[model samples]
Target chain A: SQKIEQNSEALNIQEGKTATLTCNYTNYSPAYLQWYRQDPGRGPVFLLLIRENEKEKRKERLKVTFDTTLKQSLFHITASQPADSATYLCALDVGFQKLVFGTGTRLLVSP
Target chain B: GAGVSQTPSNKVTEKGKYVELRCDPISGHTALYWYRQSLGQGPEFLIYFQGTGAADDSGLPNDRFFAVRPEGSVSTLKIQRTERGDSAMYLCASSLASADTQYFGPGTRLTVL
Candidate 1:
């Protein structure tokens, strides 16, 4: 089975700073990696997706990088705001058939 | 247009009871999925339905877990003999295709006492 791990359970950062979250996986090679944001009491919303062939992808202030060699993906939010304080999740596609998600890392952006 | 909707926003039941969670996908979506999210954890895949049949149900934890997508628009996740461990938010998502972007619903929070 594939195992996904987020770097931390929670992260605290100040507004205007860049919040970077890490996701690592083992025992599998995924063709696509995705990032999502989940607020309290709500389901996750898709943020970005990066394919194995692409080293990096950006959407507005959000950026994602996939390092297949290291079996890891990094999610970054530039100029973080209090609204960005939410649980961010990373998911990997299983043979492009299914998706497996990590536990997620909660980001707390303090104003 | 509605993204997705789930019935019974919350449910409370006793152990050994049977519970059903319902999901309504977008009007034109052909792929639907069911997942369970425990406290502080991400959503775990339970089943995937392509059209009217289940394409993959390998994520179902046990025999007690079953899902159906009759008529290809609505789905129901049925759990028999529910246990305390079954308490979690049951989520449903839908996409245009099996591997397309999935849009999730508010979810039904199930509490087993």
Candidate 2:
């Protein structure tokens, strides 16, 4: 069975620093990998998407790096702020347009 | 533009009862999907619809769960003989197409007593 894994630990970082999150998957080659931000009592909001063939994608201060050979994707937020605190989810896009999501990592950025 | 929306933010039902959850996707979205999330776990895929047809129903746990997208817009997820184990937040999402980035709704929390 295919599996998606994210760090379960709550990451604590100070404002104005960089926060990095990891997403690892096994037994699947997804066409695209997506990242989302979810707050308490709310649904996930799409953040960024990186194609399988691509190595990196960037938008504003957020960057996503995909390395299919290693079956891992790294999400980085530069100059993080307290407002950026939330659970970050990584979803793999299986070939058939289906998504398999990771349990998610809770991020807390303090001032 | 407004995003996706779901009805009955919270629902409570007794075991063996039937319940229906509704999802209204963003206007003009052609793909709709259903997911269930248990506490401390990732959201699990339940079903997906392409237009008026169900393109994928493989993730549905059993025959008790069924969904329909009539007119390819509004969708309703009906559960029969609900069990205590079926209690979870039912999520709905829609996108331009199956492979596109999906926009999710707040979700309907189902509690089976």
Most TM-score-accurate candidate: 2
* Candidate 1 residue lDDT tens string, A1-111: 768999666899999999999999999789898898998888889889899999999999999999999999999999999999999999898863588889999999999
List model 2 lDDT by residue over B7-51, tens digit each.
Answer: 999999999999999999999999999999987777899999999
Residue A54 shift from truth in candidate 2, angstroms? 1.3
Question: Candidate 2, overall lDDT?
Answer: 0.94
Give all TM-scores, in the order shown. 0.96, 0.97
lDDT (0-100) at residue B39 of candidate 1?
91
For model 1 chain A, where is the 10-residue window of minimal lDDT?
Answer: A91-100
Off by over 4 Å in 2: none
Error of 1 at B53 (Å): 0.4
**Superposed model 1: Cα runs more than 4 Å off:** none
In order, the B-chain TM-scores come to 0.97, 0.97
